[model samples]
Target: MTKAQIGLIGLGTMGSNLALNIAEKGHAVAVYNRTASKTGAFFENAADLRERIVPCATLAEFVAQIRPPRPVVLMVQAGKAVDEQIAALREHLEAGDMIIDAGNANFRDTIRRFGELEGSGLTFVGMGVSGGEEGARHGPSIMVGGAQEAWRQIEPILTDIAARFQGEPCAAWLGEGGAGHFVKTIHNGIEYADMQMIAEIYGLLRDGAGLSAGEMATIFQRWNSGPLESYLVEITAEVLRASDGATGGPLVDAILDRAGQKGTGRWAAVEAQLMGIPATTIETAVAARSLSAERDLRLKAQGAYADALPTGRLVADEAFIRDLEHALLAAKLAAYAQGFAVMEEASTEFRWDLPLGTVARIWRAGCIIRSQFLSEIAAAYDQAREPAHLLLMPAFVDTMTMASPALRRVVARGVEAGLPVPALAAALTWFDAFRQGRGTANLIQGQRDFFGAHGFERVDAQGDHHGAWSK
Candidate 1:
C-alpha cells in the first residue's frame, strides 16, 4: 500500500477546506480531528475528496499513513492547544518528520516551539496561512518559516496550493523561526489601521458631509477603480450597498458601531513599542478599536457634551469629495509606511533575513489587505535592497505632495466637527514627523535631561551631557 503525500490534523473550517484543497490538487491526504465526528462529517460532505483522503481515526493512525520524513500540518487553536497537540503527536511520530503549524500564533510562541524541537530530530514549521475560509478552500498566501530542511521538503506542496499572482505563487519561505507569523501579525496590524481609516472616512462622509449609506457605497466603488483598489475597499462598497432584508435599509446602518479584534493587531503594536519603532498609525488603530468598545461610555459622554458641541458640516461638492479621496489615499500610504518600518526593525532586532520585497509580493493577493498599491511597494523594495523610507520613494513622495493637502484639510475639519479621526490623523502626523528635518524632540530631550539627568546628545558635540535648567 502506498503512503499518503501529507497528513492534516484538525477538521475545522480552515483545516477541512485546506484538506479538501490539497486533495483537489490530486495529492493524497490523511486527515484527522480531535472529535472523530468532524472527520466523519468532513468525508460525508466532501464526496469528491473521498477518494483522495485517508481518514484516520486516531493520532497514531494519522502519523502512520504518511511516508518517511512525513509532513503533518496542525491547524489547532493557538496557545495551549498547540502545545498539547505537539506533545501528543511527538509520542507517535518518527525522527526527522515535520510538523507544520498553520494557525494565527504569536511569533514569540513559535520561536519557543522551534527551540523545543531543535535537537529532537523533528522539524517544526510555523506557517501563516491567510485569506480566510474562502482562501483556504481555494488558495491562500502561505508564509513559511521554520526549519530550512523542513521548508525544502514541503515547499513544493505549499507552493502548489497557494494563490497565484500573475502566474507566481503567493507562497514563500520568509525566514527562519517564526518570521512568517511575525509578518502575518504585522499584516493584521496594517489591516486594523486600514480599516479604522476607512471607518473614519465613512464617519466623515456621513456626519460631516451628510452622505447617505448608498452614496458612500458609490464613492467607495469609484475609489476601487483608482489607486485605492483593494479587497477592503471592494468589500466596503459591498457592505455599504447591502440592505437589511427585513428593515429595507442599508445593512451598515443597522449594524453596531463596535469592532471586535483578535490579539494579532495588539501584539504588533506592543512589539513595535518594545523595539522602539514608531508605529503610531497601527497604535492609533488599536486605540480606535478600544474606544469603539466603550459604546455606552461614548454615548454618555456624547450626551454630556451634546449641548456645547458645535454644529459644523463639510462641503459635499465634487471638489471636496475628490479631496477626501486624495486624503484617504495619502493616509493609507502613511499607514503602510509605518507597518513595513516595524517589519524592518523587527527583522534587524531578531536577526531574521526577511525579504521585504517578497513580503509585499505575497501580500498582493490572497490576503485581507490585498491592494493595487502593494505592487508599488514591491517595486520600491525591488529597486533598492531597503529603501531609506517608503515615503521618500519618488512615487510615494509625489503622492504625499499631491494628497497631503487634502489629508490636512480633512483632519482639520474632523477636529472642528467633533469627529474622532484617530487613524487618519495619526497617519498625517507620522508623515509630517518623518519629513521634518528638525523636530521638536530637542525640547523633549532637554526636558528629559532636566527632570531626571538622563543626559542629551548635542548636534555640534559628540558627548551626551546633562542640562542644568535651575542655574
Candidate 2:
C-alpha cells in the first residue's frame, strides 16, 4: 500500500500553514506554488518535510506526484485565481483526481464549478477552512462539500489535520454542490453578528456606566467565570486594558470605530430575508457598521432630531449577576437562533443535509468564531423543526425567565448612557417576536414589497390595505 498524498496549490500564509499541517501528520505531501523558490524554501526549512516535499517544476508534474487519483487542495485567492488555477491544472489531473478549493469562494461559484467538473469524472470540492494561519499550521476546522465519493478519498487526511470539536475531529462532509462554502459563508455571517454583539456590550459598559477601560475589563473578567465567557469577549477586555502609545490611555479609544468586513454577514442577512427567515439583528448589526462609518453624519442627524436617552439599574449582588448571566445565555441563544435559522433555510432551499449538530460541534474550537454557546446549538439542531423557535423550547424558556430582567436592566443602563448595543437589541427583538402573540408589523405589506409588491395590513386583516395616505 502507498502512503496517501495531499497536494497543496499555494504557499502563502494560509496555504503554507495548511502544508505544514498536512506534512506534519506524517503523510506524503506534494507542494507546489506559482513562485517556485518560496515553495522550495518552505519545504526545505522543514527537517521532516524533506522526504515528504516533492517540489514539482510545473502543474503537470505537480499533479503527477500523487500515486493515483490525486487530491489537490487549491488555497489561493478567491475570484479569478480559482479559475486560473483550475485552467492550468485541468489537462494535468486525471479523471479520478480530486480538486479541493479551500479558498474563501463565493458559494455560487462553488455550485457552478461542481457542474463543470462532475461530467469529466474529476471530483470538485469546495471546503471552507477556518482558524487562520495558526489553525492551518496546526489543526483547524474544515468544512467539506461536493460528492460523498470525493470526500471518502481524502477523509483520513482531513481528519488528521483538523482540530477537535467536542470529541470529534473538526471536519465534516457538508454535502454536494456549494454546501461547504455555504456553511462557511453562513459561519462567517454568524461570526459577524457575534463579534458585533460583544462590541456593543463593551461600548455600553464604557459610555453607559461612565466606567474607565480597566473598570470595564474587570466586569468582563468576572463574566468569564459565568455563561458570558467566550474567547472574543475575553480578548475584548485585554484590548480595552492595553495602553495607548502616545497618551498612555486605553488603546481602544484610539482605534477607529468603523469596522471592515468581508461581506458574508450582509450576504447572510439578505439571504435570510429572501428565504423568509428572521435576521433583523444581524442585518441591523451590519447597518450599525454602516452607521458607524458615517459617525459625523449621524451626529449631524442627531442635532436635527434630539431625544433623551433611557436608563435602568440592576442591584449589585452575586444572585443578580448570576441571573444576568442566564439572561446573557438566553440572549446568546436567540442570537444563534437567527443565525441557525438562516442556515436551516439555506440547507432546505439548497437540498443539502448539512448536519447541523456537527456544524455546531465543529465551531467549538479552532475557528475564529467558536464559543461555548455552540454546544447548546448542536443539541438544538438535533431536535429543531422548520421555523422553530429555540428560545420557546422548555430548556431555553426556563433559562430566559431566570435572566431576562437582569439582561434588560443592563440594556437599560446602556440606553440611559447613550451607548450602542445592537447585539442586545437584536436579542430583545427576537425574544419579543418569539414571546408576543401578535407582531405589529404589516407582515402582509412586508411580503408584498420584498416578495410580491403587495399592500400592507394597517392594523389588522379587517382594517385596511395601507398605502401612503395621499395627504
Worst 10 residues of 2 by lDDT: 309-318
Report the number of the highest-TM-score candidate. Answer: 1
Residue-level lDDT tens digits of model 2 in 318-427: 56445446556666667677777778788889999678888888878878777766777678767766445566556667778877776677666566656667777777
lDDT (CA) for every model shown?
0.91, 0.77
Q: List the residue pairs that clash in candidate 1.
A: none
Evaluate model 2: give its TM-score: 0.85
Runs in model 2 with CA error above 4 Å?
A: 1-4, 44-50, 243-250, 294-327, 383-387, 441-471
* Cα error of candidate 2 at position 44, Å: 4.3
